[model samples]
Every structure is written in structure tokens, then in C-alpha cells.
Target: MDQRTNRTFICSVLFIDIVECSTKPVEEQIWLKERFNALLSETIKDIAVNDRILLDTGDGAALGFLGDPEDALFVAMELRDSAMNDQRDPSLSLSIRMGINLGPVKLVKDINQQLNLIGDGINVAQRIMSFADPGKLLVSRSYYEVISCLSQEYAKLFSDEGLHADKHVRQHRIYAVGHYEFKKATIGVPVSRKTAPEPKEAPLTDQPQQGENRSIDTQASRYRKTITLLLATLPQRPFHKKWISAAIPLAILVVLFAAFALRGGKGTTENPSSPKVVTAVPRPKPSVTRVAPPDTKKTEPLRSTDPSISQPLSSKRVARIGFTLSAVERKGLDITLTVSLKNTAADARSVALYDNHYSWPKSHLTDKGGRSYEVQEVYFRKGGKRISMYDTGKTGIPINGGATVTAHLVFRKFPDSSREAVLNLHPFIYYGWRWTEHDVNFPDISLE
Candidate 1:
């Protein structure tokens, strides 16, 4: 038996696919294949040939790296940069999407008795490749975690795209790797600099010198001293004396007015005992009208307690189903969501919910400002244990007729000001060798 056969080992798998390869002409396609193969060879020249296996996949290829996982990411980035710089034929310019995953894969012999690799790692890497846009790269959570520990510079290149839901794999976190050339291009525009004003030189003129200006200063000083002497000679009363002299006469007038008032009131008091006919004036009482108190019986707004009521209405019946966002909780940079899915069909044994092979379900939160928060992680909340989508040993949950399952999905946190967000669930269903994506829009839910 070969030493590389029937043995499982940890490695990184990189899957790449050319964008719109079928649309190109036969000659152009041949040129692109040659160009891309040469580019890949040049990119991985530093890596040992035995440590990496390049398998052609019709339009693109799958690279298996048994060495350090970071080497795979570095190669993918190099391939992207090299392809971008390839200006031989603009029409044959190759734009590819790449995905990387790190996991245990087994090396086995194919039907032709040739050594080949197959495992969940390769499948996941292919799925992640589907998530990336043309000229972009994406990596599975496992690959990201491995490279994160190996290289900080490599880890910083990835942005958290959040949890992605695939048909085979329910939900897994994926990260988008930043392209070096794109970053440089985005920051290439230089900032405008302000020009400083030119200093104006003094005009040469027959103006008075320092000695001439000193005479003017002396004359101004003499004039100011003369004005000060005049001000000193003028008669001015002290501030306290002026206030007291004005107050004495005002006080005397107030005392005389008070004496006259007292004298005038004495006559009315002395005549009061002679014949004061005391008349009692009756006070009018305020009228009191007794009114009925308002009805305090609190009427609760009619709300359905059934869990299905909160489920968003399905726009199109791709698989005869219903989905509802039960709860959404956000803490710092993490968001937790509980979604209820019910199978509405009675005759269908198993309904295909959604297909995430080519693309993930666009399950994301959109704020009023048009910012989107993509789903980051997904799991089945079964009792106390959380079943991850990447659990290869377990198959997808089967939903028979009238059966329902609660899916717990976690998304990247929205901005702080995003109090209310519209949750959009776009699921692509695979049918008849083609994919049909259904757009299910849920009403805006509160994030508070």
C-alpha cells in the first residue's frame, strides 16, 4: 500500500473557479487555461511540489496544501494579483473566486487508481468559493482560525462576512480576504495640498524714520499729560457723599407722606363705633358636577400567542414552507436570532428548503441607513446542546409533513443606532439541475 493512501491528515484546500468561462470563445478559453495554469505554477513555485496537489476542475482547479495553512492563503492572494496584472489578452483576462478551508481529509485512490483527496474540507472550501465575488477570495472558519494563529498580517486581511447557510452545511462563519491591489487602488488618490500665500515686501518710500516718529510720540505724551492735569483740577464730589445727599431728602418726603396717611385713617376708625350697619356678604360656592369615572378596564391589544403568527408570510411557495424570526438579541459585536421554520406541505415527504451551493442564503439585517449585517453563524438549539452546521457526522434535519424546526442563527451586530432592521431571507432552491432563489422579506423587527 502507498504511504499516502487511506490516511487522514489535516490540510488546507483551495478551490478556484473562473467567472463566466462558458461564455468565452474556444480559442480564448484555451488561452485563459494556459495563462491561469502558468500563473498558478509561478505563484506556488516556492512551495514544495509534493506538499501541494493541483487538480483541474474543468473551468478552474482545486489546490490541496499539506504544509502550513497560511501557505494556501498566500498562494491564493498571489494568484489573484498575478491574474490582475496579466494584460496579454483583455478578453481572456481571468477573474476567479477562491475559497480555503482547513480540516482533516483522507488521501485515497480514485477509480483510475490515482491518488486523490476527498473530505468535508474540500467540499466546504468549494462552498465558500461560491460565496466570493469575482476577483475575490473567501475562507472557511476553520481555515481562518488556523491562519489567525499562524500569521497576524494574514489574519488582518480578512473581514468577518458573518454566518453563511449552505444546503449541505447549514451554517458556518466565513471571512472575506482583502485584495492587496484593490486596497492600494482605493487609497491611491492623493489628498490636495494648500498653497501658502506669498509674503508682500514693504514699498520703498520717503517715510519718517524712528527719530522723526519719536517727536510725534513726545508731543502726544505732552497733550495726554495736559488733559490729565485739566481733569484733576475739575471739581468732583466723592461717590459716597453724592449718594448720601440724594438719599436724605427722599427719606424725609417718605416720612411726611406716612404721617399724612395715618392722620387720614384715624377719622374712619373713630366713626366705626357710632353706627356701622354690618352687612354679611355671602360668598359664592363653586358648582360641583359629579361625572362618571372613565372605564379603567385595560383592553389588551389582540395578539396571537401562536408562534406561527409571527412568521413572515412566504412571497412565493418554492417548497411550501413558512419562516419566522422569533427573537433577536444583540450584545456588543454579536447578534443572536431564533427563527422558526415550518413545513406547510401535507403530501411532500421532504421539502427542499434552500440551496446554498452556489450562493448562501442572503439572510441579513438592513438598517434604515442602508447598512447590511450578514448572518455569521447558525446552529440548531436542541435542548442545552448547540448543533453546528459543520457537524459532518449529522445530516440535515428532516422536516416531514407538518414538521417544524427551530433554527438559531447568529449574525454580525448592526450599528448602535440601528434600533429597527428589516430581516431579509433569500434562499436559493436547487431544482431540475438549476437554482431558483426566493426572496422572503420579513417586516422590520426591533433590535432594542
Candidate 2:
């Protein structure tokens, strides 16, 4: 074990890391770095090996060892135990991943005069890292076999999930020793850092997989399940629409279908049984039918189509007005919306708002097309007088997620110049709560 060049024994390079390092925020870097450094120093000091700790790779540590595979397995297990039993701050606790490979290595001095180690040992160790779980350890067969010869301590290691030679050239056989049962966890986040060597692309084999595709499949499955559960408990109701606007579409379809059936696919050919012809049939009788000349109806311009420039250009842009409701007193309707402008743009463009207040859509709320809600009317006060020029149009605002944005709607009469009018709107709004809800926060709405 002396510092000599005569050593030619098979040595294993082991890599260890904490899983799910991405969840740790940049704000906690100081705390994480301290805990990780301390833990590594302590663990390495306790392990019986002539190994040298090469570097601190953020979430995990990299180390080079000059021992047989058996000793490497022992060191890896101890590292996992230390992490769990660590007496440090609970918030700073972490896990580790250990990789092992048997290869020749040589230690030398670097430009900074620090002891350095290199060879196939470190490479294989990183591969083992991909195979291990939070509290488990994985080792290569070369490692398992050689270490088992030295001692039967790690003979129970077995193959785990995928022969995990992931997309990064990091490949290996996995193992889960001890009473630890691997719990299925969604990879809700990703990890960062590992500057020693850039990750190389994994070599292709017989079976290849796209991890991202699996993730998408997982999300779709969750969405389907959520919909199923919601429908199971939700009340069933027929979908309706806004009056004549709704009936017109149905009427058009009915007419088209009727015409198709009557013509029998003859392409506008007349049918003797059609009402148009049947009613006029014994026509010898004085003609009682009256038909309008085609020119009698006035043509109209479509909201979108530009058949010709002869049609006058429209100057109407849909405009909306909304307001923010900060802290509303349910009793007095006294709210605090002192203009929460996060950051204004250089052009001073459309002012961004925190959120809008809306009365939750109810009876007056039209349940058109199976919507969970309807446009809720909202009101704001000016000079102690209630004004009702608001829109229930835009449903929810990007207020942290659940915030409501009542749009500017048709203005109607207010109760009186003395009394405040009640505007129908959804009350609950979410802000600054991204963890509880995604950033579905609606932008602040206004009547300005």
C-alpha cells in the first residue's frame, strides 16, 4: 500500500451520488455544499482503504481506491448508512450513488500539487452510480466477483430494473441489498452539476429507450386518471348553448342532412317527394305558393371573411376592462388592490396586474357547452357609487394559479349613486403559491 509504481492489482473506481439533486434550489447551495463536504470527509476517513478523495461533485463525491472489489462494496454501504444516520440539519440530509469498476490506475501530482488518480476504475464507478437507488448500491459483475473472492460479504447483490446503461455511456448491473424495497417515485425534477467529465452518449445496444417518451406517457396516464375520477363523482348534465346562437348550428345541420337524404346523393337533383315539389304537385289548382326573388335578401359581411374591398372595413376591436381584488372583506366588500404592478415594461405597455375579482358564476351563470363555470359579472366602486361595467368573459386569471380575471363587459345600470351594487364573480384567488399550484396564474385584468 506504499506509494510505489509496482502495484498492478485490479482496483475499482467507485462513484457515489445523492438522487434527486435537482429539487434542491440554488438558495440552499451554501447549506448543501457544507453538508456534502463534511459527510464525504468523514466517510472517507472511516473507510479502510488507501483511496484518495479526488473531488466534491456537488450532489455526490468522487473517489479513487487502490483496494480489491470487496473493500469498495464495504465502503459504499457505509456511505449510505452515514447519510441516513447523519446528525446534521434535517434539511441538509442527502443520499449517495456508488459506482464500481476494476481497472488499473496510477496516482500522480497535478499542476496544483494535489494527489490525482486516473484509469478505468473511475469510469466504471460512474456507471455503477446510474444503477444504484437512494439508499441502495450497485456494482459491476467484475466488482462483485473479485470482491466476493476477497470476502463473501456482498454476494447477495442482484440485477435490478434495466441493465441501466443509460443514455450517458454510464451502464451497469444494479442491486438493492438489505430490507429496502424500492418505492416507485415519479422523476418530478431533474438534477444538475458534475463538471469533472462531460457525459458521453450511451452506446446503442439491442434494446433502446427514450426516457422522455416514457415521461410523456406517464403524464398522459395521470391526466386520464384524473378525468376518470372527476367524471365518476361529477353530476351528469346535458350541454346547452346561448339561445338562437346555439340553435342555428343544429338547424343548419338538420337541413343539410335532410337535403342529402332527399336528394339521395344525386347532387342537388330534385326529389318528387321533397316538400318543394310535393306541395306544388297537382299544380293545376290556382298557384297558391309565393316565392321570393333571390335579390330580396341583403348580403352581410362576415366577422373574418374578406370577399371584397367593396365591403366597408370594420373599426371595432374587442376591448375589455378588469380590476384586481387584493384582500376583500366578505362583509363590507372592502378590498385592497393598491395597484400591484410587479414590473413595468419600457414602453409602458398594457399594465400588468396582480389579479381581478369576480363573483363565482352561479344561477345567472350560463352553463354553455359543459363548462365548469360561466362568465361571471363583476363590479367596481368609483366615488362611493357602484359601477357595473365589467366582463365575466375571461374566466380565470394567472393569479398565482387560481386568481380570477373579470373582463370588461356591457355596462348596465347600477343600483344607485349611494348604494354599492353586487357584481357576480368567483371569489377565491391564488398568488405566490407556485408549489401548491403550477404557474397557471392569470394576469391582472382591468377596465382601463
Q: Tens digits of per-residue lDDT for model 2 on 1-448?
A: 3454333434566677766675778757656666767766665674455444355566776776653234455456556666777877776666666666666666655577665566666766676666555666666656654443321222333333323434342335445444222211222221111111223333211123344322222332332343334345546764221132233334435445654676786776655444431010111221122322223234331121222222222211101122332321111322211112121212211211112243322211111122222322334333344434233233223322222222222222211221211222323222211111111112221211
User: How does each model score on lDDT?
Assistant: 0.60, 0.40
Runs off by more than 4 Å, candidate 1: 181-448
Q: How does model 2 score by TM-score?
A: 0.36
Q: Give the clashing pairs for model 1.
A: 162-376, 163-375, 163-376, 163-377
What's the CA RMSD of model 2 in angstroms? 29.2
The residue-by-residue lDDT of candidate 1 on 1-448, one tens digit each, is: 3666787767889999888787889887887788888888888887787777778898899988875556687688778877877898775678888999987778888888866889987888888888777898999887777555432334456677765556555666778877765433443311111111222222112233233322212222332343334345546744221132244344435444644665574664544223222111122232232323322355332222343334342222445666666666667766666666666777422222222222445466677677777766666644455656544123444456676666665676468776656666654433222233455665545666
Candidate RMSDs in Å, in order, are 32.2, 29.2
